[model samples]
Target: MYALYYTPGAASLVVHWLLLELDQPHELRAVDIAAREHKDASYLALNPNGVVPTLLVDGQPRYEAAALAMLLADRHGDGAFAPAPADPQRAEYLQWMFNLTATLQAPLRLWWYPGDLQCDDEAVRRGARARFEAACERLDAHLGAHGPYLLGERLSAADFYLTMLMRWSRNLPRPAHDRPHLGALARRMKARPSFAELYRREGLEEWA
Candidate 1:
């Protein structure tokens, strides 16, 4: 069985969502980041990075959320979360997913580590927040132009990844609500059946 090492309310949310979408039989194993269980020796051996959301596919460990999503999508069916490889939008689909990880997710990490790593200097924190807002604004505008999903109409892995990011970003004191379209996109995604299923399995009551 597919064994997913996850931490509830973490990046694992998307992985959980996608696994439910695939309707595959799998096991959800929680790794407590608070107690430092993710950093344990065995977990380190399985995933040297010691990060949560490691997918154990038939015993071999697979880390990295985006790569895991792509692998799962491709394995389940080429046409699942992403379009067929030949589709014109495929390029943008891949681009958005990676861009979310590199550009969008970085700022959220700053929010998590604000006091420790980023908020040391007022000027530095302000600059980081400014850059983060710009990125979110760009995403908001692009999402508004698309009018539903990142790919215009159909849902893709890009939307799943991005929507989860937006949701977490919204929880910050600054909130992504200022970006109405982005907020709407996140709401639409949260309302999805697959998202609800994963949330339930993970015991994420706050997500509802």
Candidate 2:
């Protein structure tokens, strides 16, 4: 059985969503960050980074949300959540997944936990917000051009990853919903049973 360690609304959400989407039987171990449980020895052995979303694949530890998503797609999705190697859309699909992590998700990390940047200045906050919105603007344009989903008509695991990010962006000056196309995509995705189940299980009420 698959086992996952996570906190609500953390990067783990997308992985949890994927596990449900694939109907994969799994176990959830909530690492209470509030109590510093993640930093404790047992959790660290499974995930050295002491972060959420650590997956035990056949009892072997796997971390990184994006990597776990790709792993799931590769193992079980069979060109559904991801385009296969020979598929025409594979290159673009790969691009969006990497870009989603680097360009979009990375900045939101700093935005949410600015203390990681080692400065509490308002200027730093402005810079992080600008980076976040800029990434969203690029995604919004892409969604407008070819989207409601990341891979055009195909809804890949990338779409779920993006949705998870956008949900966290709800408190920003310009949330994902502020962008017309992105907003529409989010609205459509929110209707999915996978997302609904994620929120219910995670107890995340915001941006649901």
For lDDT, the strongest prediction is 2
Misplaced by over 4 Å in model 1 are 115-124
What lDDT tens digits, residue by residue, belong to model 1 across residues 1-208?
7889999878877887888888878898889999999999989998998887899897899999888887787678557688778989889888988888887777777666666563476655565577678888888898788767888987888888887777676666566645788878878888889877777787877646
For all predictions, the C-alpha RMSD in Å is 2.0, 1.1
lDDT of 2 by residue, 1-208 (tens): 8998989988999999999999899999898899999899998888899898899998799999999998898788666799989999989988988998998788888887778878975666788889888888899998999987888899998998898889888888888778899999889989998888888998988887
TM-score per candidate: 0.91, 0.96
Cα lDDT, all candidates: 0.80, 0.88
- For model 1, what is the C-alpha lDDT against the true structure? 0.80
Pick the TM-score winner: 2
- Separately for all candidates shown, the number of backbone clashes (residues 3 or more apart, or on different chains) is 0, 0
